[model samples]
Target: MIQSLRLATALLSGLVFGVGLALSGMLDPARVRGFLDVTGAWDPTLAFVLAGAVTASGLGTALARRLRRPVLANSFDWPTRSRIDFALILGAGLFGVGWGLSGFCPGPAVAALSGRSLPVAVFVVAMLAGMAAHGAARRVLLVR
Candidate 1:
């Protein structure tokens, strides 16, 4: 029963997220690229979307703090890391580079897959490969 509820919640949340992305023009690589172009013809749509996201996140965090546990989960799965490290910085840098170059962050890229775009498909494939490579490298490093 709980598992079904969790699955339903996840599906609903993803649908909401994908719809929001599509409506906000986030699924468009050109729009995203325009937003990233600070010195060129910049678009402020991404900023508005980001502001909305940040506000939602802040509200959710506040509500979570007031609750004993998540509504659909046993407990909160908060990040265990508190301090920034070299690996964190490197990962962030890599993520930024990929986003800037492709204009398709993970969420939007995945959502864009519904459009059946070849470029989006390529981006998703590359993103998955990068993730797999990172996992493999991490395992190797940990084993060293």
Candidate 2:
């Protein structure tokens, strides 16, 4: 019963996220591009969306940490790192560059693909290949 409830919650969360992306114009590459442009006709709407997400995620994580046990899992799975290191900074810079160039981050890229955009399809394929390479490299490094 707990697992079922968790599954339902996950599904609902995804649906809500998708709807929010759509409603916020995040599903549109043009809007994303406009925000990244930062010229005379710059759009800052995405910043507002990101601010809300960060605020909610921050609060939820803090609340979850105080819980005795995770609702569905036997234990909580949390990252130990509180410090930002070189790798983290570099990875974030690369991710931002990719988002700026493609005008579609992971979530929005997937959402855009559902609308049948060729550019999004190509971007998603390249993104998947990059993720696969990263996983392969991580596995090899961990084996040693």
Candidate 3:
């Protein structure tokens, strides 16, 4: 069925992404931290990863624009917002700070969890808590 196919595709995509992260040393906090340390013992490996990600993203976007709809969906779901707002700025700032401090963004952190690392588990728990708190705060603000 189409639903099963979609699930399989999603699983495969996630597997590939996780494998890529592992291979790129993105799952290693030390490597990521080294990359962020621009002034001392800088590692440039992550820069190559970032460049590859950007290139893939650019190619994907271009391909999406040429298609009428996604291969497995009814239509393409793209961002509707164009304006830069306070919420966007705040969210980005928080994300950057978190990444710089922990060297683990959401995707890489989740992928790193497979190694059963205590620190990674703690980071994931904190990340989930932050997401829940953000959702709750957003709901409260919207209710006013």
Any runs in candidate 1 off by more than 4 Å, and if so which? none
Q: How accurate locally is residue 56 in candidate 1, as Cα lDDT from 0 to 100?
A: 100
25-118: candidate 1 lDDT, tens digit per residue: 9999899999999999999889999999999999999999899999888899988889999999999999999998999999999999999999
Misplaced by over 4 Å in model 2 are: none
**What TM-score number comes out for model 2?**
0.87
Candidate 2 lDDT, 70-124, residue by residue in tens: 8778998788889999879988998999998878899988877778878889999
lDDT for position 13 in model 1: 96
Judged by whole-model lDDT over C-alpha atoms, candidate 1 comes out at 0.95
What are the lDDT figures for the candidates, one per model?
A: 0.95, 0.88, 0.96
Worst 10-residue lDDT window for candidate 2 reads 108-117
- Candidate 3 Cα errors over 4 Å, as ranges: none
Residue-level lDDT tens digits of model 3 in 8-83: 9999999999999999999998999999999999999999999999999999999999999988899999999999
TM per prediction: 0.98, 0.87, 0.98
- A best-first ranking of the candidates according to their lDDT comes to 3, 1, 2
